[model samples]
Target: MKIAVITKTIITSFGLLILLAPQRTHAQLVPQPWVSVGGKDGDVTYSVGARALNWGAELGFGPDSATGFDLLKFLSLPVVSPYLGLGYYSEDKGLAVSGGVQVGAGDNLFLGVGYNSVRGINGQLGIKF
Candidate 1:
């Protein structure tokens, strides 16, 4: 199906980007990780994700399982980052677009709110290392 091809392409592109990313002197022990919960059409969905080098990926499970990838850009402001994302869900749901903002709760904790065409509104909690 068309969705299968698109999914493969996206996975390949993300893999290439990771492989070609520049190396840095300091390394992170762990990427920023988060959990998200949302609902759509009375069904709830749960997802997990991680962010690093301005890029993030997530996987959702429940009534509408999906995989998502995003690019996060941090604003000049002290504690806010906004992101735009694309996701592939069940056959019926197909593709979805999402956007959100994340605010740093402190030095290591963060909170986020986002909306997805298929997943509806979500709240996220994460930790930065």
Candidate 2:
């Protein structure tokens, strides 16, 4: 248990350090690992990965929702990072929403659950610049 805590702390610290470090003029961006717990179409599904750049995506599976995939990234940032996500492989076909802060911290990650949402939880697993 202590080891796990320490590992998490170290990982978090590393992530924060990278986040706080000075930026390079042409440095590449990476994805951040993020996990979310929520429901879709009244069914539960959790996302467990992320990708960097404007061409990255995520993949995860759930019981009711089954296997799912998404292609989303920062498209617009007006006080919040707006993204375009397309989800499929669920009972209700798929969902399309394009007005959420899908990029960066301080943004809600647990926005979908127990409702008519597509992704119950989606993790941002890397950075992109």
Candidate 3:
């Protein structure tokens, strides 16, 4: 009987702690949209992408038109956030691999440079809310 009472009290205390603790919203669910322009073999490629929760999806328009999806892993850093991603592109572009470092330009703006297997070296500009 004593053990049962103690268990109930502990559970109540934990529940109260959980209820009173600060609540954090998952901001990573908000997508960060970016535009990129790149060149390969004298042809220009334009692409747009959005990232959320360490995942990204992109659509490319230009010579090598394709749709791609990527899983992004970000490194914890001070000024710059560097990421590496592995993806697959449609339209015969095959496997896509990319790496980039993004630097915050201002409060809500970021700039990046990355290289994609199908898109070549690209510059990225994005905004985060």
Lowest summed lDDT window (length 10), candidate 3: 18-27
Model 2: per-residue lDDT, tens digit, 21-124? 44344322555455555555566666665545433355656555466676654333333333445556555546533213444444433222121145544433
Question: How many Å off is the CA of 3 in candidate 2?
Answer: 55
lDDT of 1 at 98: 70
The lDDT values for all models are 0.71, 0.47, 0.71
* Model 3, span 64-99: residue lDDT tens: 566666555554245676666667778888788777
List the candidates' TM-scores in order. 0.68, 0.48, 0.68
C-alpha lDDT (0 to 100) for residue 28 of candidate 2: 26
Better of 2 and 3 by lDDT: 3
What TM-score would candidate 1 get against the native? 0.68
Q: Which portions of model 2 miss their true places by more than 4 Å? A: 1-28, 62-65, 76-79, 90-99, 103-117, 120-129
Among all windows of ten consecutive residues in candidate 2, which has the lowest summed lDDT? 108-117
